[model samples]
Target chain A: MSHGRPVRRRGRPASAERNAGEPATRDRILGSARTEFAERGYDKASIRAIARGAGVDSALVHHYFGTKEQVFAAAVQGAFAPAMGIPDLLLSGDREEWGERLVGYIFKIWEDAVTRDPLLAIMRSAVSNETAAAIFRGLISRNLLERVSAGLDRPDAALRVELALAQLVGTAMLRYVIKVEPIASAPAEELIPRLAPVVQRHLTG
Target chain B: MSHGRPVRRRGRPASAERNAGEPATRDRILGSARTEFAERGYDKASIRAIARGAGVDSALVHHYFGTKEQVFAAAVQGAFAPAMGIPDLLLSGDREEWGERLVGYIFKIWEDAVTRDPLLAIMRSAVSNETAAAIFRGLISRNLLERVSAGLDRPDAALRVELALAQLVGTAMLRYVIKVEPIASAPAEELIPRLAPVVQRHLTG
Candidate 1:
């Protein structure tokens, strides 16, 4: 439930004496992985550097997350953790207001540096590198889009989810990463109203 | 206008004996610049490499486009050249069909590698480098969005133009650059209908 830390999944033995500090160490490795990926990008970043950043041995990092790609994938999963609840949010809310809710939640994530930085890192890597792109693609499709699509009864639900996401993702690229104006400088409140309907239409209309 | 080649403007003198073949040389430099930026990204791309790519001297690259940023700007302009007429396209169409027209036209450009490659290069650079991002922002704002915004009578026309663009840009990032499936493999024909309405709402609604 921690905002930026990797979520420790259930069913792992909780009381093993040797595993006592495993979660913290694992979280630290993941944090280091994010920083490495963010600063060096996917192609240039290395597992050794991520371990060094975490102040752990390379063996420990490898022990926890198998390959460099797996490390990157874990980092991605952590970065996306906060937003993972979106499907639940959508399912719980009135369908009519889903657009406003989706836009509002995503913008909030983007507006905050803690959450935004990792997502931006993931995007920068995905755009320029094939391996990273595939990782991102697989994760978003499996974790994010499919969940949202499952909530929709329509046959084209998956495609519709992507179109709506494309709207938000494009807005984020302009506003945060590329920082284009007037999209970049405009207040989030100003944008939410204008963008909500478009997202709503893509999802429900 | 060549699809991937930089468009030479008319103001430059045509008959100078020393300037014979100037347009070809200039276009060559721009072509080289696009490849360099695309291959190395904005930060690592160099004038020396670009010049070498074009089989010209670095000085010649400097003479044509002053700084790395300037070279990048020219490349951005050229890459965007095909889409530059979008304002006219939007203006001439039955206002109601502008969404379909705009989406259809952009997808055509993206579907073709010649036009899409330079754009992909420009986007890669822009997302990773601040200087590249600014140059891209300035050019898109001045050359593309401003022209589109000018045609609309609404006070919020500029914002609307950007939001609509955000949708397409994001979709392009997902479908082309990142190659996310469902959206990526989905035929343009299938996507255009679903997307055009969202764009129409942003632009005219």
Candidate 2:
């Protein structure tokens, strides 16, 4: 990939370049942003560095993502894209087994390197920076929790969904981020059966 | 609150000062370490800064806590001191209601700003830095999980203890650190009942 080289055509207007239908370029910038934020964290990451990592111009990054916070938001969104199907997954499964399916699905996503990396970056940023935390909070509340809770038939659906999530999120932090032993090294098969029932009780009990 | 001024006695040997049996000074250094680690994180926080914060000489910090990592470990131990009674609490309670007691105890700790602040610092450091994470993992595994698991009758007692912990830890991250909505605002009275059962099941089910 080109590194820090401006790819803009000399005769083309910056606005035209900005509007150009280049999904690949936009995706590349986002990938770079995830890396930058992951490595340097939110406070230290800059538009120039992200552009350099993506082999695009700094101006293009600004045009595509708007600002540092905006760039971080887009990165969080992109990172969460894979897991966005969760609500659908929750709705499709047998209601009694939703806990198993939910736990299984989350474990699958977290177990893979490709998906786990960006999510890890997003998590690290959220824990350390208030701006990043707010963006993450908004997305999770709107995109994930709201949809899942809406599908539930219970009265305290939102609270229940959040509790179910707390179980999963806490497991992920121990198993992945903190790498606490036993929990970290234990196989998913061993954990799912144990965890799913508790989750099921929270959702359907 | 002295800032940066050395409090070493003139001509006194550092070893003699180190062994002076001054519990108050040692506690003050630990408190300062927690604040520095919480504010600057593990990687950015310095021994010099920690000493300065405690209003003690740098030599005294080294004497009391051998290295920056050692200081962090001591600080983590101090922060965790309050929660150390948990294993005893678990052993003392009726086996079935251990979950309620556990959840109640933890929420009480996190709800209080005095106990919560240092823990938040430890968590932030653990998530962001590898060395800090290891220290935290070791401490949690040895001090909390092992003690609790030892009292359990199940063969997978260690894993069970960890899962129970994951539920509370995840809740803490969302409710306290991330401050996610609904979960963040939901009163402890409401959360305790819903969460206690899951925790109970994990421990005894």
Best by TM-score: 2
Give a tens-digit lDDT track for model 2, residues A81-165. 9889999999885898899998899889988989998999899888877889899999999998889888996778888888889
Cα displacement (angstroms), candidate 1, residue B121, comes to: 1.2
Best by lDDT: 2
Return the TM-score for chain B, candidate 1.
Answer: 0.88
Q: How does each model score on TM-score? A: 0.86, 0.90
> DockQ score for model 1, please?
0.63
What are the per-residue Cα lDDT tens digits for candidate 1 across B1-205?
A: 4578555554433456225546777888898999888667777789999999999888877766789988999899999899887989998869899899999999999999999988988998898778888888888888877888889778888889899999999999989988877898998889999889888989999
Clashing pairs in 2: none
| Candidate 1 backbone collisions, by pair | none
- Score candidate 2 by lDDT: 0.87
Candidate 1, residue A117: how far the Cα is off, in Å? 1.3
Worst 10 residues of 1 chain A by lDDT: A9-18
For candidate 1, the TM-score is: 0.86
Please write out the lDDT profile of model 1 over residues A110-201, one tens digit for every residue: 89998998888888878767888898898888887888888887888888888888999999998898787788899999999998988889
